[model samples]
Structure formats: C-alpha cells, structure tokens
Target: MKKLGFGCMRLPLKVKKINSSIDMTKTEEMVDYFINEGFTYFDTAYMYHDGRSERAVREALVHRHERQTFILADKMPVGMLVTKGDTSRIFRHQLKKCGVEYFDYYLLHALNAKYLERAEKLGVFEYLAKKKSEGRIKKLGFSFHDSAKVLDRILTRHPEMEFVQLQINYLDWEDEKVQSRLCYEVARKHGKDIIVMEPVKGGKLADVPEKVKELFALEHPDWSPASWAVRFCASLQGVICVLSGMSDMAQLKDNTGYMKDFEPLTQKETDILKTAAAIIKNEETVPCTSCRYCTASCPMNIAIPEYFTAYNKRLAGEDYKLYLEERAKDKGKASECIGCRKCEEVCPQHIEVVRLLKKCGEIL
Candidate 1:
C-alpha cells in the first residue's frame, strides 16, 4: 500500500447525501492526477455515505483505471449484520458495487469490545479467512474504534490479521478516550503494520483557527494544513498509509501534491505539532472521540455520536461556534438524550454519555 490513501468517507455531497452525482469530470481528473503522482491506495466502507461510496469509487477510479494500478480497500459492516449470512451478502454486494473481482484489503469495520465479541461469537474472522483462501480478499485486518486495552486483547488473539486500521492523528495522540498513540504502540508491539485513518481528524485540521493556521504558516506558507496532517501520519514508522477523505478538487489537488513528494515531518515540525496538539487539547469539551458505540444501544433513537461531536465543538469555545450551530440542527439534540444509560453500557471509554448530554444541553 502507498503511504497516502484516499479516504472515501467525506466525499462530495449533494442534497446532504453521498452525492452519487459525483463530480466525475473533476474526480476523474483528480484520479488521473493522484495516480500520476504515485499515490494508489483508496479506502471505503459499506456504510460510508449510505452505501454510495462503493459505487462512487467504481465510477471514479475502478471503471476508469486498471485494477493493478490502485489498491482498493473496504470494510465489512459487522454492526449492521443481524446474522452470519449477512456477511456474505454485504461482501458480495461490495464486490458488485466497486466493480472489483478482489479487494486489496478487507477489514472487520469499526471493531470494539462489543462488536469484536459479536463478530467472534458469530464466526466473522473465520469467514474472512475462508474468503481469503478463496482469493476474494487479499489482506484481512480490522478498523478499530476502542481503547488501547481492547486493542491489545484483539491483537493478542488475532495474530492472523495482516494489519490494523486506526484513527491516528496529532490531536488524539494522547487522548484518554481515543488513545491513538497507545493503539499504534499496541499494534507495533504485536508486529502488525498500521493503516492510519483520520490523520486530519475528519478535516478539522484543514481549516483551523487563525492562530493555529498562523503557527503552521510560519513554517511553509505554500503548504496547506492538510499537508502537515499527511506528513504527521507519514512520519510515524510502521505505518502503511494515511487516509485522507478528500471531497473537492482543491483538496484532492493539494493532497496529491504533498503526497507525491511524501516527506515525513522534521523534528522541528513535530515539535510544532506537539505544541499545536496541546493548544487543541485544552480547548475540547467532553473529550469525546465520536466512536458511535453509544449509538448502538440508544433506546430513544438518539444520535449520541453526533451530539457528542457537536458538544465537543461547543467546548472549543468561540472558534468552533459555527460547527456547534450546524450540528445542533439535527433532530437528535443533546436535550433529547432521555437519560438512558444504554449508551454508556457499550462505551469502552466509559464516557458519561447521558450526563454529558445534559451538560451539553446546558452549555449549547
């Protein structure tokens, strides 16, 4: 896999949907530019953009480009599967959606303590092994969203996994809940290669506060903040690639520019990032990681993850008020949490979801 993989999660949207109406003219141009620049890895999941991501990748890259030219990676949506048979159905559907004969990488999507247990009890890992043996999937691993301790357990138990995908970035390097660095270390200790996702924290690092942007601009005014993020993930040893969810032509162009050159961060740049991380750490409200385990058990159909994401932005104070206002428009407001502890039950981070929702309601 290349050092920079294009994440298909936050692809261009139209009418608040995945925008199956992909800007193919520009997207095709971006794909040509990306491959010409020597970056060839693309990551998507079944649930991303409500299943439109797979088809979009087909239209944007797979159909237009040769199979061997790029590595296509997708994850099994284990959370949505109600029975063991659903795995084959979704995997088969993915093959059709992406217009691919085999996946370069396949993952057990978004594993945590609960989901891992579910997958194990239901024989998902074994099923993936069979698919690999049959040559439908090339490499098998998992995308994780839990604590370091849970990660340690998973790696210890599943040494057959080729690599692990993690949500790693400067912001969550030492986060108590996310523990990006801790999970990376755990994987490395197990001798597993890492696929880094969210190196830019869902594009939060792209356009940051003026002060944060100014700090980075002092180093290289020509480089976008996105470059620094890609460099940060690239700087980490044992990483196979850093996934960037590019949504527009400008972002794709800028990212491919830096990724083509593929330079890791310098010692000075690392120090600057560390300082910037500190600045961001002190500003976050609730310290939520947006893992969405809370949503699994919500009885009132509350969108706990969305609320927490919005609440964190509210905690960032004045600079992120726009984010707070936008997310607050959702039907599942913090005030609608219903005080159910169901969300807390599945949270590996043990976040006080109900109480925090209450606090967010007060603040926002």
Candidate 2:
C-alpha cells in the first residue's frame, strides 16, 4: 500500500453537499495522477458524499484500474442497518454500487461507543468474517472514532481484526478530547496495524494560523502546511498509511510529492509542530471532534458540534465579541439547550453538557 491513501469523503462537491454533484473530469485526473505515482489505496463509505461516494469510486478508481493493481477499502454502513438480514443486503448493494466483486479491505465504518454496540448486536463482524472466508472480502477491520478506553475494550475482544483505522495527526496527538496518543498507544499495545485518518485534522491544519505558518517556514520554508501534518502521523512507530481527503489536484500533487519517498519528521521538526499545536489548542475556544454522537441524542434538535465549534471560536480571546456576532448568524445557537440531558448521556467523553452550554450561551 502507498504511504498516502486517498480519502473519498471530500471529493469535489458542487454546492458544499456531498450528493449535490461531482466534478467527474477533475476526479478522473486526480485518480490517474494518484495511481500513476504508484499509490494504490482508496477508501470510501456509504455516508460519504451524501451516500454517493461508493458510486463515485466506481466512476473514478475501480473501473479505471485492474483490481490487482490497487486496493479498494469499503465500509459496512451500520447506521443504515435495521436488522440482521440487512447486513447481507447492504453488502451486496455496496458490491453493485462500487462495481467490484470483492473488497481488498472492508471495515465496520465509524465505530464509536454507540455504533460498536449496534454492530455487535447486529452481528456485523460475524457477517464480514463469513464473507472473508467465502473470498468476497480480503481483510476485515474498522475505522474508529471513540475514546482510548472504548477502543481498548474493542481490541481486547476482537484481536482477529487484521488492522484498525484511526484519526491521527499532530494536533490531536496529545488532545484530551480526541485522545489520539492514548488510542494509538492502545492499538499498538494490542499489536494492531494502524491505518491513519484525518492526518491533516480535516484540513484545519492544512491552512494554519499565520503565526504557526511563519514558525514552520523558518525551518523548512519549502514544506507545505499539509506536509507538516502528514509527516507527523508518518513519524509514529506503527502507522501503516495516512489518509488525506484532497479536494483538488493541487493538493494531490503537493501531498504525493512529500509522501512519495516518505520522510519522517526529525526530533527538532516534531518539537516545532508540538509547539505549534500547543499554540492552536490554547487559541481554540470550542474543542469538538465532530463525531456526531452527541447530536444522535439531542432532544431539541440542536447541532451540538456546530454550536461547540462556534463557542470555541468565541473563547479564542481575540475579537471574541466578533466571534459572538458571527455565531448569531446561525439559526440555532447553544442557548436552545432547553436543559435537555440527552446529549450528556450519549457523550462518551462525559463533557459537562449543561455547563458548557451555559458558558456558550453566555457568549451567544
């Protein structure tokens, strides 16, 4: 597998929505360049691109190349499953959608505390394992978004897992909210091969604050913002590949250039990034990972992640009043909590929902 895997979640969107429309020509060029560079890992899921990602993969990568030349990773859509029989149906649909007979890599998509429980109850792994034995799937694994403790518990019981995908980047390496270090440590402790996602923190680190950019430019003026992020994940001991959701061809070229013959960040470079991450963490007011678990149980139909995002920006301490003014543009702010405790219960991190909302409301 190539050190850089193309994430299909952020493929060119027409109207900022995944299913609005796709730019086929641009995607084709990017895929051609990606494969021409000797890279062969592509990842997609059901919910990506507003449920059109699988079909786009068929149009972009799967149909264009021989199955033997590249590896295609597809994920089970547990959120779409309503019963045990639905698993086979969804799997078959995915096969038809991607126009592939078998997947090189198959995962239980977006495993968190809630989704993991749903998967276990629905016998997802059993179905995937059975398919693997039947030669329809090559390797079975999962992409995780959960706490270190939850991840540890899952790995302990399912050591048969061939590999695990995690969100690993410099920003979340030491974050209490994302707990990237602890989660990766747990995966390594269990001897699981790690597939890294969000190496650029969903593109937030790609275009960093000017101060942080200036600092990195002093040492490696030629390195792009994305290079610093990819190197951070690649520097880790057990990372197999880092996934970058490149939306344009320029990003594709920039990333592959640095990742071609991968260079691990030196101790000095790593130290610099750590200092930069620290500065950003201090500046960020709301610390949300956008996992969507809290919104799963929100009673008042509030978008918890978006609210927290605004709240964090307000607390950034620079032009906070301006941040508050911007947040007012949203129809639903944090003040609409209505004292609902549903979100708190579903939060695996046990964030003080009411308290945080109160603080956020004060800002609003």
Give the candidate number with the greatest lDDT.
2
lDDT of 1 by residue, 1-364 (tens): 4588888877776545435655556666777778887889999989877678898889889998989999999999889978989988888999999999999999999999999999998899999999999999999999999999999999889999999999998888888889999999999999998999988886667755566788898988897877887789888999988898887878888887777767788899999988887776665466567787777677766766666776665444224556655654555667777775888888888888888778666755
Each prediction's TM-score against the native?
Answer: 0.79, 0.80
Which regions of candidate 2 are displaced past 4 Å? 16-18, 284-311, 314-364
User: Candidate 1, which segments miss by more than 4 Å at Cα?
Assistant: 16-21, 284-364
State how far residue 73 of model 1 sits from its true place (Å).
0.3
The worst-scoring run of ten residues by lDDT in candidate 2 lies at 314-323
Please provide, for model 2 over 77-151, each residue's C-alpha lDDT reduced to its tens digit, 9 standing for 90 to 100: 877788999999989999999999999999998888898888999999898999999999998899998899999
lDDT of 1 at 319: 43
Q: When superposed on Cα atoms, how far off is each prediction in RMSD?
A: 9.9, 9.8
For each candidate, how many residue pairs have backbone atoms clashing (under 3 Å)?
Answer: 0, 2
